[model samples]
Target: MATPSARASCPLLLLPSPPPACPSILATKRTQRRRRILSCRAAVRFDRRDVLAGLTGVAAGELGAHPGLAAAEDASVVSCPRGETVTDKLLACQEAGQKPCPPTPAATAAAVDFTPPTSPMRVRQPAHLADAETVKKYRQALAAMRALPDSDPRSFASQAAIHQAYCDGHYRYGGPAAASKDDAPFDVHFSWIFAPWHRMYIYFYERILGGLIGDDAFALPYWNWDAPAGMAMPAIFKDAGSPLYDANRDPAHLGAYVNLDILNTGDTVIPFDPQAVQNNQVVQNNLCTLYVQMMRNKKAQDFLGDKFCAEYPSTVSSGTSGSLESMAHTSVHIWAGDPGSSTVGNDGQEHTGADMGFLGTAGRDPVFYSHHANVDRLWHLWATKLGRSNFDDPEWLDTSFVFYDEKPQLVRVRVRDVLDAAALRYSYDDREPLRWMDARPTPLLPKGTAAATTRRSLLRGAAPAPAFPLTLTPGQSVEVPSVPMPPRAQKTPAAGGGTQPDTVLVFDRIEFEPGRSGKFDVVINVPPEQAAAAGPRYSEYAGSFATLPRGGNRSGETAVVALVLPLDEVLADIGVGDEDGAVNVVIVPRTQGIKIIRPPRIEIRER
Candidate 1:
């Protein structure tokens, strides 16, 4: 792996060091006095429930008041492009005769003895393995959630809103942008925050479902799309009369068995014959993809993602996403949502997909939770079975997010508190050992002398090149000059004597317009025609950059995103040597009609 210096650098690295000594007494007094004044004002606004909460020995002061209150009521609110309050937006929708917005519940004191479930429940199994009784209970719980009024935080609408608030960039808190204007949207994807953020999200969501059904042991069943037996949409969720079923999903995908490998290419309708040789081969490919994403990716940055700090602009992502987040997480979402539908509604207003495809409406579908449950399971496996560790950066540990607890009370949680799944009182049911570990494909390599020549050539050409940031217009291609191999990679031996050293192409500081549904494909040293036609073969294709329709900077500022593509594998597949040379990189538009505003910079690194 590349050293810290070799890794892409960002301004966020200059985070505040240790603080200085104590300030003057007068300054301290002024600070304390200001706190007292604010405390008094907050106390005056508190409802009777706040007093009762304090009386229970859990001081209300310890729980910070709603962070959005001040911004929600500011005089500048009228100038806000969107409605000042969430309620105002809801009212506007109602006035316009659009779909009625879910109501927000009144704040109330949490139950005095309320606590999350502490006893362990047997880990949930793939939906296919669930018994009839278990399926019935799951269906009943979902029905209850749908029956709830929109106002209740545990209600299906409210639960989905929480996810939209975080992922769609609607939620704001006190930050650099908050004082003069609204803060940038808080997003959990495309950075180191992905794993831990989703873990906590599903944790509270599970608790809410259990509370509604009064089943503390209730566990979310996983969509085991990795296995051929569990490849079809679970029968429980497909029942037409069930609350778990959503009408907006792809009609053809309902009963069809999924081909996880072909999800990205929009060819998910593979015939469901378990005995077919082609079906078995696809299953093996899926397992191999899993092993590469989970086990082969050993570095923290390559697995969890890049470093994210408080200083990093909310509009821009500070790190590259891991393979799991990019491939497994994103592909499943696209496959599940209606593929032919445009994001723009008939009224010309943008709306989220009502199925698993779009980010804003993903949580609204009952199956999203179960899909994420399996994603969370993969993280657990990475930590336990693969021996991968979470990032130790203090900034990562200290960063926190707020969620509504089972009491429907907003609670703050930090990343440090959720490293263990058992602490949350749930686990997955035992499954067969990883069969992919023994069935991996053999490494491809050159002859012995040729391997040494490639390594020596790479080392001789290892001069650091100046960074280049290219702007790509639609149908335009830019070539990166002087791509260099890290010196450390030359000393590292290939899996086989002739195998290529692991290398990656890093796209840093990618910025573009928010809410645009465009994607750009990266091609390496190939003609435009070949690059455009590149399929799953590593030879001509690198990865593509996909953008979420929501979650752009509301202030109209650009948001930067990052991606990492395996370069050595691409080179090896094409019989190209990584000798110190200037390689041409072609950036082509994958989705036409959506223009590129600001393109990303590219660099190559040792993985």
Candidate 2:
């Protein structure tokens, strides 16, 4: 997917819209949520920097005739190369026309409200910790699904195809990439839909497995990648002869520790050595990464992703990926996919990525389900342990998707129906997030340039910022020194009258060429002397984000890429949690070929 000789003249610029002033009088929880969402959608800044778009017309996909949100016909949630391109290599099945991609069963077609399973709650255990009997049952269930004919809806192949059709295969002819069957192609990734959709996907899959094994108590095991003990590829998934094994995973990673930050950094650039790299450091890094993804990303939108409030917003297409979906979840996929360091030459095909690495073939691997089980588990913990809330928007609540249950019946379910794990009759065996909560990165003393170090001499809000729309090269990094943290005790009252507001670091906007994957790592507050340590191993290493190659930017429109990172844990770990002065923004390029259209800024946002 090459860019045209010329690019779009008006590149999409996403400025942070301030959350509304907290109401003078307290509002109901639901009303407060609505106001927060409306305000987040109200980011129309018209400073001397650039003129913001206006509400000349309603943006597509928002509830019809909304009073607050505005959109121009030209506006888009994502901006791609001038023409839509397919960056994802996983779509070869769809491209080669192996089988016609199925249109999404209409949410209106034979749709029934989801009924919570009457069975007792199935507690999902860690794949590595399961006993011999549990492993045997799990293996047997998968073999049963595999034994079924491809035509059977409950067959393993059919289960994999559901992911393929909805995510990678939606655009056969590629007109506008609408969610409806007539318009063609619907995607569940890169939006609020990611969590709920996957929850239902595995839920039904779990049900089918239980029916196969005659155990209603069966639960899907999660790949507890967040903890030290469960970091390696779960042993159950490594046996080549087992039904659980995936032949396409990286050979080098077979027995190595699962490095959560193994995407652009892992691509054969670092030598594969489980013994050398797997240490207390890697485990600590994994924990901090979880803390950042779960705690830092507190707001419903930031955690769940861009709101999928209504019918796919073909007009406001391309919602931003939530922190979890785009960060650890994605990195793990690449790590497990065939040959993280190399292209798909071994198979004599130049595919984009191997099984777990690419979205199209992710479901082909059994470990993928366990991986998502962890993701879903974290969502459960985020909501329960942190007491966070999902989006309360009606469209968010009503958005529906279709699936096949163990009964092999076509069933349609909505976002509202899948929000609760308890209601769905499932729970993680190990729900406590104890080991990693306190694993925030330790700060190393600064030994470099005064300008690059923490602003001891520089006055608050006085340091010069980097030039806007900067292009980053692989070897060269940019450090935006002396950025102010979101001030404590801000005007915006805490949600539900909580103790304090959350402060976050926002990397304003980054652009991507259509069909080409997007990549970057965010490291905050590290001194210049310790800059070399800007990775997941250190507390300053906030997160690494990747947007898998895709068919196109949302509706071939402009989509803003803003990376919001919470600072509560990082600031506290580095002993600056109580302070609000300037911290350095160090942008490290883990891989090559990325451009930051807008620079980094700090804001006081509630998680």
Best by lDDT: 2
Best by TM-score: 2
Q: Candidate 1 lDDT, tens digit per residue, 1-607?
A: 1111222111000001111321111111111111100000000021233222212222324323322222222312111111011111111111122221222212112212223456556468888778777788788888887787765666787777656545554432233322332222335565677777777778877777777878878888888776667766777787789988876776677766664444333453655564563336456656655655665566656666665421232231234467657656666676677755535421244645445777767777777888888887887777777666666565566455555666566555656656667766788875745664544333222323323433343334422322334454554444332233332234356565642334555454455555544466676655444445443323355556665455324334455555556555555544555332323455666443333222222232332
Q: In model 1, which runs have C-alpha deviations exceeding 4 angstroms? A: 1-117, 176-182, 257-268, 275-285, 309-319, 340-348, 432-482, 489-503, 516-529, 532-542, 551-558, 566-589, 593-607
C-alpha TM-scores of all predictions: 0.68, 0.74
lDDT of 2 by residue, 1-607 (tens): 1011101110000001111221111112221111101001212121211111111121222213211112221233332211222211111122222332332223124545567778988889988788787899999999998998776778888787666545553332222332232222235665666787787788888989999988998988889888777787888998889999878888877777677766544443333343553355566666766766776777765677754321233323434568768878877887788744333211122446568876667788999999999988877777777777666655456555556677766665666667777778888887434566665455554323322345443332234555656776655556776554434445267556863555666554565533445677766666444554677556566666576644422333223455666666666556553232446677776665466655565556532
Instruction: Return model 1's CA RMSD, one decimal.
Output: 17.0
- Candidate 1: worst-modelled 10 consecutive residues by lDDT: 35-44
- What are the Cα lDDT values of the candidates? 0.51, 0.57
Residue 418 displacement in candidate 2 (angstroms):
1.2
- Count clashes in each candidate, considering only residues at least 3 apart in sequence or on different chains: 1, 16
In Å, residue 217's CA in model 2 sits off its true spot by 2.4
